[model samples]
Target: MCSEGKTTPKIVRGEGGYVLEDVPHLIDYLPDLPTYPNPLQDNPAYSVVNQYFVDVNDNVAQKIVVHKSSPRGMLFRRAGPHQRVCFESDEVHACIVTCGGLCPGLNTAIGEIVCGLYGMYVVRKVLGIEGGYRGFYSSNTTNLTQKSVNDIHKRGGTILCTSRGGHDTLKIVDSIEDRGINQVYIIGGDGTQKGASVIFEEIQRRGLKVAVAGIPKMIDNDIVVIDQSSGFDTAVEEAQRAINAAHVEAESIENGIGVVKLMGRYSGFIAMYATLASRDVDCCLIPGSPFRLEGKGELLEFIEKRLKENGHMVIVVAEGAGQDPTVESMRSVDHQDASGNKLLLDVGLWLSQKITDHFTRNKKMHINLKYIDPTYMIRAIPRNASDNIYCTLLAHSAIHGAMAGYTGFTVGPVNGRHAYIPFHRITGVQNVVVTDRMWARLLSSTNQPSFLSSKDVEDAKKGATDAAVGRGE
Candidate 1:
């Protein structure tokens, strides 16, 4: 089933006892390809380690805490230096491209990839695709080396500029073939990973000796099959600063209300985590949870009650919250950007206005409201300590997998262990905040209403959001 790319993903499996979400290898098709000793076997840095090469059949279990009667469940190929490799040092020509919007660890990921290929494998002749998918055919390539990327990790955003849409798979594959590129690295969010999957399919259909590797990167931490993605820690850390500022402003005045809109695309992870960390947020709103500003399940009434108790309150809202057609039907936008994403209503601005109107005119209460939309700021900063370390692990894992001739795979931590996941298992998938222990913790910290029914909470745990904030389908 893995050889033909027909394995069911673990998260969606209902009745299956157990499954292996294995990735593809060059030997699956090019059976006659010769092997070479891993370059790491002689590297001094690795000689100090107790164990290095991972066994070929080694895998990580996706679910460890199953019922006594349940099977071992899904497993993914463990990521590490393989005992043997297929690509020789000189024949490996690699090109990297970053797509979608800015993420905190993008530059760090790019830097680690370049350094891993150069320092460990001694692979020269690496190219950086200038501007996402279109960069393959439309723009020039930048020569990448350890020296060039040495200080990039200290910077923010991708050194290789990114963009949205304009994903021409044919032309991009053609460029790969024309340039004799055998290894491809793509870094992006969910939509970009979907594009990478199509590119992998094309390469497979053509029977090319190419390896396409995806680094699952979404600052929202909404990609499925992984415990968490890079940039999430950094985003959460940066978001706390905004929450702190908002708290200061709210507490310093009478009848003060602070509204902070966080980025979760179609989910509520960022808002949820930031609110939990702040400890001052009185309310939090996210998608898949039914919330109404007005009605029997009134959020405004709760806000009023909270203010009466504390004299000040902070509200944290996910970008995807309040997106119900019934709430925003008249203002539902039909326009899309170049990436073809549905332009969502700015819930922050509208909520601010609603709060202002309800207090100043509707209730005849004078109030001071501060709305902070740190959507771009949080993601645009450099990677934090934890995320930088995470980026290093992901980058090296991807480099090792690609160099060992693994293709059509994405690298990420599954159950806190790095593993090579197939493109089919993760593409078009989204991970949402569930009413789990963590959500319960957030509720306790914020002391806010559940804002959702039991069924809606179940729906939130179903999976990732279909429509991202600014990216395409």
Candidate 2:
């Protein structure tokens, strides 16, 4: 058998078969199991691609394009194969990195990746890149092994740590080559995934054989066509606790307004789902649905009416809500994070102040408003049972896809199945709440006014008609 320096393995026809290459480093850490000829020999799926041991020219295929024949359209990601195999078990050296903000399931995903690579592929040289993209060029790396990460899933933050910004793709590629790494598993959100695509392209340009795979990790649940990303379910569950607290605080006082601000840079799935789960929410405000601040039966009138009838009310607002039309004029966009996401204005606090002013000016009742912003608390907790399982499955699928030679794609849940999707298709897009279906349900359950002004009512009617015509109803 040929070594790493050789192009291919030499086949011997006279002998019973070609000898398996001796990779002592890969086998030294594993236990001897004489009873089983091969741990994965029985399963063809996990068998080595170079079983024949012949010299063949390197021929890489084009990207794996999945096509479906359904009128209603198919799952954005569907079941598929990698179309090519890049590396064998022993010759592969892999690295796993996490980027962007904190999420509930980050640690679990890390543990799953380490365990799957070591246990399934017997990969010994697995390194953890620290502090996101900066860790690639810097001297910050953590050695990963099966025993080292056995109980990491029980924790919250990433074992390798993470950071934003610092997207030097060329330097990152130099670091990968310097470390002799052949496969990379990146767990992050949209911005981080875009950086991964650049790194993958640079590796190809350098004539190096490296596989890059991404596991989508959006807590906002805003990646298009992905049914659900890791950490979303856990975030929704944690937000419910805050909503419960708001309900209690609002009920204890007279004319109380419990305001909750959730984390959503440009989407509002967290706020929407939390409000839906906690039926105590009187009004749900999101980035997708805009409401009037003044006029007959508007936000002020709705709160006043609710106070007169029930004496207290709970209002849930997404951080990105009411920004474009209402809050943008009142507030200035001065700051941005390392990941390039604009720092949102404090909508919850602004709304609370406005409510207090309107009530004080009326001189009818006093306003006892309670503001709750639980962004950090929700993002720091360990993964719940559902998210833990979801993270583990995503990690396994990522390892399989990376070893199978898939590049520039992220593993996501599509139609309740783990599927690989190209990064470019979903990078700039967003998964928003369907107003007609989801907002209609929220309005019905909360009994809130659909539209506060004449213009809003006209827009709603036009939207309904457009939707009906599209659906051929």
Candidate 3:
């Protein structure tokens, strides 16, 4: 065998078939072999053959060098220890921003981040990106000093304004780069998180050094991994309170029927949790309740029949309940509030009318209909103690991860606790679909009537038949 330095080994035929001589050991042959360079290392092309040697012309060669493309003059070098120290100094600037609809604990999150970065990490200059992604691009920003964020911890809403149209990926990255922002903290739900991921990719593509972090903020509690979202507990508490009050009212009126409608576009966590908490809810109708259009009509007839037999009824309905086809369609035809969310009052009213009409025509019995909508009320109450503590812990974990150089992650509270996990690990966070297991668990934990029961099934089917004939009216 003939070996050449920095070249592939060659075999030569001799008088004795083939002669094996000057054969470099396998370990010594690696340095001369072609290999790719590390993209992150400085002068990576030149810093090749770290620990191995090569054989050249039947002799052992100590050093074998391979040349490749390199950065030309004026290109920024990989950060050195001193350079990194200066670049990540206390003077380095950053900002936090919120976007879209108002979620619970937004102020708490912002306050914690501002305090932790400035007071604990010595990151002094932090700006708040107002109006979300649109603000980032339109130069809508506000300086967040320690004093400005002090009283914000107790506040329920976002101190920095938010908007849905704020996040344009390219424009946001350009703004970040232009501002020399070293770090950015984005607070929102899935939409904001996706936007953050896009911005990170664009910045890395441009070879710019910046870090982005995300905090989950949606009252719907649709995000995975985190068992609970910032505003969910508060919303649930409010829902339960309203439900309990309605139950009392129904009991007080002596034979009066009360219907309370809640907000949960697709997932029934809010309705499920509230129903579980209020053991007196006679019938709970949520999206994941195994009720089809036929089943829904059956349910209304069952209520009318029950009211005729027992003089009183209480029903809880999720906003996503009934076969509405689509949430947008439901919202469009629905009587919405100022924020464009479907008004639970309208839903409750429609269902109540149906129940009243069914009983009046079928039994010639007049029934009183009381519709109660607890949508906004659920978002109005102060956060529960458990929720406040959980939100604070989640905030702390998020900031800790960020200071430790973690990225592409989300912090949340799960199963009455707090935990941090990578964003991609969440499976799917955008859609508003409910997991069957969760729905089943919520139903099992509640005292509500099960659709699978023989009596419920029979009553529901009879009601469906009556509604189909238009005789239930």
Q: lDDT by residue for model 1 over 160-233, one digit each (tens)?
A: 99998856788888999999999999998777777887888788778899999999889888887787878999
Estimated TM-score for each candidate:
0.92, 0.81, 0.68
**Top lDDT: which candidate number?**
1
Question: Which candidate number would show the highest TM-score if scored against the true structure?
Answer: 1
Per-residue accuracy of model 3 over 1-473 as CA lDDT, tens digit each: 10111222222334422222221121232223222222113434324635321112222111123235421111001111110121233545878988767766788888888876665456788899887777877878889888998877676668797866424577777898889886778888765666666665566567665556678877777665455678888888778777877777776764678788887665666777777777767777775445432255467556656666667777888776664533333455556543233544345556666677666776666666678887766654446666666656666556544443444556664433333444443424322233335445555654344544466456546644553233101
The number of clashing residue pairs in each candidate reads 2, 0, 5
Worst window of 10 by summed lDDT in candidate 1: 464-473
> Which stretches of model 3 miss by more than 4 angstroms?
1-89, 292-297, 308-310, 325-349, 413-420, 427-449, 452-473
Any runs in candidate 1 off by more than 4 Å, and if so which? 1-18, 325-330, 454-473
Question: Which model is ahead, 1 or 2, in terms of TM-score?
Answer: 1
Report lDDT (Cα) of residue 284, candidate 3.
Answer: 77
**TM-score (C-alpha) between model 1 and the true structure:** 0.92
lDDT of 2 by residue, 1-473 (tens): 10111112112122332122111111122223111122244346556655421122221111224245312222223322333344566777889999999999998999898888777666788989998888988889999988889888888888889998757777888999999998899999888877887776667667676778888898998876567879999999999999999999999998888999999776888988888888999998887667778888788888989999999999999988878654465757568888877878888888887888888888888889999999999898899999999999889878766665556567777556566666654465353444458877888878888653567656656765664444222
Give the Cα-based TM-score of candidate 2 against the true structure.
Answer: 0.81
Candidate 3 colliding pairs: 5-56, 133-166, 133-167, 134-166, 227-414
